[model samples]
Target: MASFKDFNLSRKVQDAINDMGFEEPSPIQASCIPLVLEGKEVIGQAQTGTGKTAAFGVPIVERAGTDRRVQALVLTPTRELAIQVAGEFRKIAKHKRVRSLPIYGGQSIVHQIRALQQGVQIVIGTPGRVLDHIRRGTLKLNSVQMVVLDEADEMLDMGFIEDIESILKETPDDRQTLLFSATFPSEVRRLSARYMKKPEHVTVNRGEMTVPLTDQVYYKVLERSKLESLCRIVDSEEVSLGIIFCRTKRGVDELVEALLARGYLVDGLHGDLSQAQRDRVMKRFRTSDIELLVATDVAARGIDVDNVTHVINYDLPQDPESYVHRIGRTGRAGKKGLAISLATPREFKLLKQIERETGAKMEAREVPSLADVAERQAEVWRNRIIEAIQGGSLGHFRAILGNVIDEYDPVDVACAALKIASAGELEKREEEDYNFGDTGAKPGMVRFFINVGRNANISPSDLVRTISEEAGVPGQTIGKIDIFDRFTFVEVEQESAPFVYEALRKSRINGSRVNLEPAKPRARR
Candidate 1:
């Protein structure tokens, strides 16, 4: 289809899509949206990050109404994906009167029950949690009209196939079913064959299995200091014509502005830009006028640049396919390239998920120290001076640099002059929060000591709920939690450490006042 208009979707959904800045449909979205909207069972073979969520989400939201009796049920393999899928439904149904809820393990069943009682139009959850809710009689699937098995292969791998079968049997036999998976093993095929009714099969294969010429790695850093880390890396590496990916349009614009302020030649691309505007940015980027392009995933598609030396993930991608697509922007035309991702400790699970899905091992590295940055900066400057000398005549700057060139290599003189001009701004961010002192957590994680555990009549769910609700962060970001008789130790990503600390400290939990602080690493055994 040429445009989203070809789908003939309702005005509200189309508007929401427009607001999302998506000018075109992804291959999966284009193929499955129409059939799913027609109320047909579909077996869509595609990788994640192909906008499959919207393909199904938009149609589901359009088909369901304000009845609020769970018209649609989406089964996922993990709590993280449940939250993510549910969030997508909420976003797509923002213009409608639909209500969606995500129920999964590590949460309060009582709370989920209460939400269900209040009337939910859509339910998204893991198989185990869904079956639990079903057996407990707190959830009713009799009224469900559409059932979606997202990441079918993942659910099978996690050994949730039995739970999935149990939950599916509870739904009405006539309901529309949609199954999406990256691969179709015999087990998945059998599952679909039994559940779906003459399903239409659509497979969208990925482009050349992850290019062999790319070197993929990630750096762990605190969120607040991420910008500074990016600058240091930029100065430290030879990024000739690169692309830095952000998860959202706002992120793209922010990073573009930040880098531009730091004297980097960069430009931004996102859905918000007009076609003319996007064309101009691409023109500049291809012509090498812009050293870096800060872009969102949706806006960076169909971009084939051969000399992009680096592709930086300013924010971790939502799935592995996005990681592959972003990194593929570099390492084209037989040239070697680097793919770097800036990850927070809280995002360990997602990083692992990507690695599992793509079979790409990303080496975790620490952010460069100032000394390292300085050393790299000198080398980069020397190369720039040499390139300039080889490409142009000396008449342009000989008069100004002639005296210094007499005693020093022209490269050294140029480097010293540029350093003085910039005043080392790229290496500086004095107020940036850089560390979580001795939290005994993993390399990129922070361990917290909380006062109030079992003795305080608290459950891990309560702590998760309090921290997630009070701090206004997603509950999934809360990492491995340990509860004790009178205290607890919770590990959070380093980026969320300070927020979780300030938001939960001195707050009341189960009517008992609480104390929370970073804990020192325990003595090694």
Candidate 2:
């Protein structure tokens, strides 16, 4: 738990860490930084979300002389991680006035080439692109004194191991190498044995689950149907602030666009955002101005929001440790939180591993039905009308209604007038649910909770019909319904909760919109 100052970091790096609100070093940083600074080849065993970036980052910034000859190179498994690690390096180097550029695919290779021509002291890139640059004669590692393999195991998993070795061959023979990963799999061990010179091994064990408060669940979704299923869940549930984790930056951008078309207040975060854009998005998310954040794994790291009510895995993570970090966003400060993951058949093995490692069972759930969506929309209207009635502030509209009443049969007129007043609120939501139908789930069921019950003038049929219409979850899969004075609960598959939550958030009952947070244990009998 030593501070950066204790580590004797340069004034510039220390100031930057302070500005970023970093106080004490994490265990990995505490152990690895010293070894790295001593010019030793080191293997760091650590999980994501631990501050390993700064561990090797500090020494590289300090040791990499400002001769501007590609003094350091950082290789990562994916483009997103490469960009992120590069950003961290630039922040530390800002005070020193050093230049570090990130090179990755799906970006303009010409632009990266131009930057390389302009003379960057450090380069960060994915293995494929880095090797591409090397073969194209754009990147020269002749002057490199330090090289880092961030997430070595991930590179192995993604079949980037061969590219990684080729990238290493280009660096100076006398250079320092640091390899970091959650697990040192056999391939990683082989790579180190071949490339590293008797590297010092540093392992830091995770002490306790920081996210014990997060209520975690999973939906058994198919690879093809996940998008629609996710939409239904979001429509049915009442989540305040949440994040959806996608494996790639491309996936993040794609989902953000899809969610926006469906009328959810959302934004995207990933390696593609400029530093300024990243800052702005985070500000809005933190201020509660935006309810949903779609992000890739690398871009979502270092995010420490405590109020996130939910974390959805739009794509499964590469490892069990990442699962822990993703869900850690919620259930903070003694408050209840939730995590829902969407898993396809091929990804179930990884899901099982995550469950085994965390000692938590993820409940399987079904897709929501179309009936569930409509019913939920109606409830939304009911709550709106009730709120208006109870607030007692319709003085201007009262005269207009009175005139309409005089012109028609009193009973028929009254019923028609009620519908007119409720139409506008219901219309906006109506267009929203149906327009996103393609994004709705197939016939299925899920479990959920309602903020209203018998005492508050609600019933099981009301809950069933509401969830069915809004989330597209069927009434058949909707299981035992429990009603209480101030709340109601229903049992459905765990998979359908996201869609159910989405529908419920938009739906209303009685005069008050029911607040359907993830239930605590079971609803009160």
Candidate 3:
């Protein structure tokens, strides 16, 4: 319950904390910040999303002098984490004018060298890149008074233990070393024994890897039906902001494409993306421009956005630690969150392993049915109508209703007005119940074949735009889309299929003549 004000920090540091809207110190921050400020070598054992960044960052920023001689060095396991930690340092040091730079791979080292020449007080980087800089004589650690090993266990798992040792050797022996890891494996202990000078150990929330504020659930789904199940849950739950974790870059891309094809506002993040691309995606996600982000486990490291309402595991992680990290993205800062996992029958063992490791029971949830989705949508519509009525802005509409009532039965007039107001919702519900044919499409939708596909370099967004603009079909009404090598299959509402088909039949996509027709049913085996 202690506040950052009680830390005896300098005026500039306190001002920065206040400006960042931090009224209190998390448990890790409360315990470690004071020790760090006192130049104590402290070992912090805490999971992700526990505000450990500020615990180390605040003191690093405060202790670093204005001379800007790279006095503090932070080593992370991944480039994303390096960038994230450096960003935190920069934010906390804004008023104090302490400079922190992130050095990592996939970036121009020449640019980093130029920045180093300009002077920087704090350098946050991955161990590999940091070692490269030291070998090149570009990063001088002789003046470094403090060193931090964030996510030390992850660094070990990534085979950076040797590099970390080398980096530690270059720094001054009198430097304070702070090591933080979610789990205290033997390797971390060895590292601390070799480098840390009697570091004080602090552990918080070690028993439960998963946060209590998050509602955890898992669904038993077939591999092929996972995408359909994901869509159903997202639609039924009305997830505003969420992160979907995939097992690989290819999975992330495929899921992102699937979600985009369904007209969901989403993007993908993986190791293949450039730093600039990653930055742009994160910026948009943070600003709520993107509703959902599909990311691989390695790519999502150090992502600390707080507004996420849900964390979905599209693919069960290979290990329990990854599972914890994926779900930890949500339920942050005491906000309630939802974590869902889609698992195939074969993957159920992995789910059980995660449960055993985390010691948290995941409630089993069924895939939402079409009726369930309709009910959820109706509830949302009803709430909106109630709010509008409560706001007293419907007076003009009431007068018109009264005029109509004078000519017809009041009940009939009310029903007609309700129908007009709820037309879109009603149409959606009716479409969900409509069957397309023997193509095995989802109810309420019909599948259509389009000539343009991946070979034409057409993306899901392009297809959605073409259908919406040329075919006059609303984007939301479009369902799943599968683009093959030479053609694409798209699902549209049963009622809108004809309009979309006819509109695109005579049109051109990417300057090529387009062909559109209902998809042929496949022969059953």
Best by TM-score: 3
Candidate 1: stretches off by over 4 Å: 1-208, 383-447, 455-484, 489-516, 519-525
Ten-residue region with minimum lDDT total, candidate 3:
427-436
State, as a TM-score between 0 and 1, how close model 1 is to the true structure. Answer: 0.48
Per-residue lDDT of 256 in model 1: 91
Better of 2 and 3 by TM-score: 3
Q: How would you order the candidates by TM-score, starting with the best?
A: 3, 2, 1
Model 3, 123-237: lDDT tens per residue? 9999999999999999999999999999998899889989999999999999999999988889999999999998899887634457778899988665545787788889788
Ranking by lDDT: 3, 1, 2
243: Cα error in model 3, Å: 0.9
The positional error of residue 361 in candidate 1, measured at the CA in angstroms, is 0.9
Clashes of 1: 1
Give me candidate 3's TM-score against the actual structure: 0.72
| Alpha carbon deviation, residue 435, candidate 1 (Å) | 6.6
Listed per model in order, the count of residue pairs whose N, CA or C atoms clash below 3 Å is 1, 47, 1
Per-residue lDDT of model 1, residues 128-219, tens digit only: 88999999999999999999999888788668889988998999989999998877789999999888999999877544345667888988
Per-candidate Cα RMSD to the true structure, in Å, reads 17.8, 14.5, 13.8
Residue 187, candidate 2: alpha-carbon lDDT = 94
lDDT of 2 by residue, 459-488 (tens): 778777766655555677677777988777
